[model samples]
Target: MAGDVRAASMTARAFVEDYLLWTRGQRAPSRIAGASGDVRRELVALRLRPSRGTRRGRPQITELRTDLTSPTAGRATARVIDRVLGAQYTLRLDLARGTDGWEVTDVSA
Candidate 1:
């Protein structure tokens, strides 16, 4: 069960990474245009496509801390510092144990 939770956390993290990459113009145009306001803003500012030759990947998730706000409510907030492109940012997640997986209801950076 713990492993499942961690895996879900990691998957959610990956989804965020994809969204960021799409925003930064590193991905295709269609994908880029799909981002919401927050993702688009980061993408425009991150300018990742210009710095794509760096060693580390984009928006690396460097730190993550979890808080169980209630017995059935949990959250994880992360600090993603992009060494090559993006500004120092924080990713917050309002997590809950769901029937299928950990559902991230809120995400912001």
Candidate 2:
């Protein structure tokens, strides 16, 4: 809610962010040959979706950011969903109940 991108420009920006992040981590973290493929996997993990009947000629992806919703503050486990350009994408970020604040335990995509 607080960090998600909702508008078209925001979506486009997020898409660029994910692509860049994936490419950046490819060589250092993955140590694989295909950095572009890593980018694809990262995009898919974001649960990107395009318009129906819009011709899936090209892929559309967005890198979303969101904090734990007020309602989900106390849950032991929960999946956070961020709406981007009208499509819902799961953030894959795990939150833990901390002493000071809710900290992100893990995140991918």
Could you report the Cα RMSD, in angstroms, for every candidate shown?
5.9, 11.5
| lDDT (0 to 1) per candidate | 0.59, 0.36
How high is the lDDT of residue 33 in model 2? 21
Please, what is the TM-score per model?
0.55, 0.24
Clashing pairs in 2: none
lDDT (C-alpha) at residue 24 in model 2: 33
lDDT of 1 at 74: 66
Clashes of each: 0, 0
For 22-99, candidate 2 gives per-residue lDDT tens digits of 433322323322123344455456553444433222224433344444533311222222333344444344443334
The candidate 1 region of ten consecutive residues with least summed lDDT is: 28-37
Against the hidden true structure, what lDDT does model 1 obtain? 0.59
